[model samples]
Target: MPVARGTKAQSTKQPRASKAPSVTENVPPQKDEGCQAKRSPSSPQGGPKKRSAFGDITNAHKNQAVTGKKEGVKAPTNKATRAPTAPTVAKNNEINLKKSLKKTPPAEVPVEHEKDSVPEEPVQQVPVVEDIDKEQLGDPYANAEYAKEIFDYMREREDKFLLPDYMEKQPDISRDMRAILVDWMVEVQENFELNHETLYLAVKLVDHYLVEVASMRDKLQLIGSTAVLIASKFEERCPPCVDDFLYICDDAYKREELIAMETSILRTLNFDINIPIPYRFLRRFAKCARASMETLTLARFLCEMTLQEYDYVRERPSKLAASSLLLALIMKNLGGWTPTLEYYSGYCAQDLHPLVKRLNFLLTYQPCDKLKAVRTKYSHRVFFEVAKMTPMDMMKLEEKLKS
Candidate 1:
């Protein structure tokens, strides 16, 4: 029976092979008939078995490879060529598939695998506190979210840039000379239409540089101009050129001299000139109090006056700013420093009293005739003439502080 079955299969395959050409010649030129004829020899019986879609696709690809043509093209009928070519084509297809898979991005991880891959960390809970910037959420430029943190960072930086009474170390230079230089820088700042920050930073640079380097009286103006040039570059969007600084000096110092002094100052301070100044703190603290523009300007005038005073040089910039705002509040009859100011400024009313008294004394008893630049600049109507406003009475200031 087995011999009979083998003979039947051979007989059926031989007849199909013999009829393949005759069928192709008689049939219409249709792709289906051509594919049916091509696949007939691979079957053992009179008809081909039904194939799955995947088997059809695989067979189509093999036909395409063996014939070196696209799908729907006639496949070769020779079994010798088809059998040898199919394996090589299939092996090549597998190699190409592997290469393509390597080039493709990895598929998404399964949820179970993903969960096991990385252990989740516990989320940290931050302590809740009063948010001063809650109302300023719409104003991106206010940086309201970071305002408190930024001021705290500035307070920490204050310790690094703190100054001492360095006047005793310099024999040729005096506090009067330093004050005169700062006063002149204020005028430069105004004449150039630079930001008030430029003036404050310039004063800071000069103080820090002077703390480390001894200067002669003649080179003082050079130092001052160079400091302004550096500060302008740091703070101004469009800083004055070297030639502008030279002209401002009435050509007292050459361009090379100013440039050299700038280099000297930078090197002496190790190029860390981001010194905190009272002006920054004053503006921030004023916001805490919700101060009027006029009151803020008054605080600003007081802070600017302190720039020319050697006595206040060692004071922390935040404390100086807080005290100036406090003094301005009392002078305006706006009451003493409130809890908001104390909270933000980090100084209660009592912590500010000593500096408040000194500031008041400086405002009331202005003696330097040569250092009138700050006073003159603020006396202009543009600044609301805050410099011309009367200093608060000492007794009333004291009483306010006590209360």
Candidate 2:
């Protein structure tokens, strides 16, 4: 203790150890943390500084700090040397992402609401007509189903109001006699090129009047023949005389009686002489098909033949006409079928065969071979039925026809 002596270790360690104290203790804890975290005016530094965190530091400051010298340093008085600011673009992008996530989608438009908003205007929808060939339309006969419905309706109505027994018991005529009458009448329609509807109308009138009013004991043949006589005058330009009808009826009806009954029948029909026939429809359908005259003729023949069948008489006039025409065309080997008939029938392609079979059966069962001459003379067979008379009665009718 008398003399201050310098050790070799103490001298060397003194400067190095002293430098550590200044460097480690001189930096303020709060300020250092603020400088690294973010540059802000409200930080522990107490004043706004423009320098960024990334801004370069002066070489003099670095040297002084490394030497542990605090000659001019005052707790980093140049706070302007602040850390670089974070990217503003990055912060803004993050805010925008949050906003988008909270946004709602637009609502959908409703059909009814949109429709109500539109202006009011009438919309014209055109009817779609099938573009069938002219020939196909020439035959107007439709399906038998419609015909059946019509006939069924009529028959049911008739059954409800059965005629008097006196009227039902009208003179019986044999199948041959009826056939003979019908044949002649069919010829008459053909010769004059008369409408088949007229014939059907005449037959309908006869059947109705005979069942409802005419005495059963009276010759039913007379009533039938007279109904035709009246119908012909209404339908044809050239009507036959009462004598002509008498001749056709084989003298079964007198001129006075025929005239009287004709008046009665006319009254019953309400003078509605314009009976619609399938022939006109047949022509239309055949035209649609572009069919030959022979084809049309055959279709017409079929339509006329359909008239004799009890089913056709009961059917809708149009449908009966269409079916008949189709059957005729099929029989004649004419192709190019129109769907018009099928549409009316509400049938598929498969249903046509059964309809045809029914038609054929009806036609086959109703023979006209024996009535050829008589029907030709009358242009109508209103009172003829092959099944209604016996062979002896037929002979008498034949004898009368010859007379």
Candidate 3:
């Protein structure tokens, strides 16, 4: 051993050959034997961990016990100790948060139900009467072999012709203005002897046109007369000439104006005029009710009156026609919507109750001083003077319905 002048002498003793580590050795340095993990008999030095036949749980217990007894042994001091249960508690909290999210209810979505998904909120329907016999209902149809099939075909397709929210969209023109137009068109239809389909389709075309274009209130009549001309061409084998429409409008509109308005309507509607109407439903329901020509005329009179109603335009045509026929039945002292009517009309009396009240009001409604054409026209003889029959204690009837 050498000693430097300013430094202390080095120790003469060297590490023993068996205790010193070689330069390339991988084995860990020696530790207290009593605190080390117990070695298994089959495990060679520096090999894989020895595990119990059952599981690692036995080794975990042994490690815990040995670590508890080795408090004197130094472990790394850098780690911060946490509560023994902190990890498990944090995991439980995370699980609870996930469960709360899963249990939270979501908003309801709208879906169309097959079995008449229409709202129960007083749909334009008629009232159900007490029990009555079906045998007493006289069958007036020439043939009703497949009337139900025809009703279903049209009813299924009625949704296509649904007009936009015109009352909301056409804010410039009031509903009263529309009422005046319809009242005047009724006279025109009667004067020209147009088919009832022509009138219904004409009204529908005018609504669709008004929905697409933002016309001033003054142009509303021109729109209506133009729609009538268009519908006549569609429904009549020989449609009225443009000049005839001018005569109906009292030449308030020139032929060129009518023609231009017709082009605008066809463009607005995309020329798609094969729309369903209340008249078709009326015919089908009349045949199903086995109604007399007088009864059909009365129902037609009631249905025609509704065209003047702005709110009623939103109603399904089938519903409107059913309401009218049901009212006519009660007025005529016939049963209140027998099952045969239900089977053919595809509507129960309850389905018509809301609409029935509306029609009753319309029937009993007195037009404003300026509007008397509907009242005056239906009061005539050819229409069976149904406008006069509208006063029959529409409120009172011996309503007897059969199951």
Top-scoring candidate (TM-score) = 1
lDDT of 1 by residue, 1-403 (tens): 2333333334222121222333333433333324423543233432222233224433433333222233225543443232222233335445433443343224212433454444643323322334568899789898888888898999999999989889999979988888888888888888899988888888888888888888899999888889889999999899999999999999898878888898899999999888888888888887777899999998998888888889888989999988888888888888886667777887878888999999999999996877888888889898899999988788977778888
lDDT of each: 0.73, 0.46, 0.66
User: How much does each candidate deviate from the true structure in C-alpha RMSD?
Assistant: 18.9, 25.9, 22.3
Q: Which ranges in model 1 have alpha carbons more than 4 Å from their true place?
A: 1-130
Which window of 10 residues has the lowest lDDT sum in candidate 3?
1-10
Could you tell me the lDDT of residue 202 within candidate 3? 89
- Looking at model 1, how many pairs of residues clash? 0
In model 1, which range of ten residues has the least summed lDDT?
A: 11-20
* Candidate 2 lDDT score at position 146: 53
> What are the models' TM-scores?
0.67, 0.44, 0.61
Q: 1-403 in candidate 2: lDDT tens per residue?
A: 1111222333321222223224334543222222222423343433222232113112112212221123224435454233212232223223333332233122211433345445533332322334444334445585433543553454344443332333234455433343444455566555545666556666656545655453543455676667667667777787777777777667766778877877777687666545444455555556545667655554454555554444444444445555555555555545424465454334333444445445545544545454334323323333223223222233332333233
The regions of model 3 sitting more than 4 angstroms off are: 1-150, 390-403
Error of 1 at 20 (Å): 98
Best model number under lDDT: 1
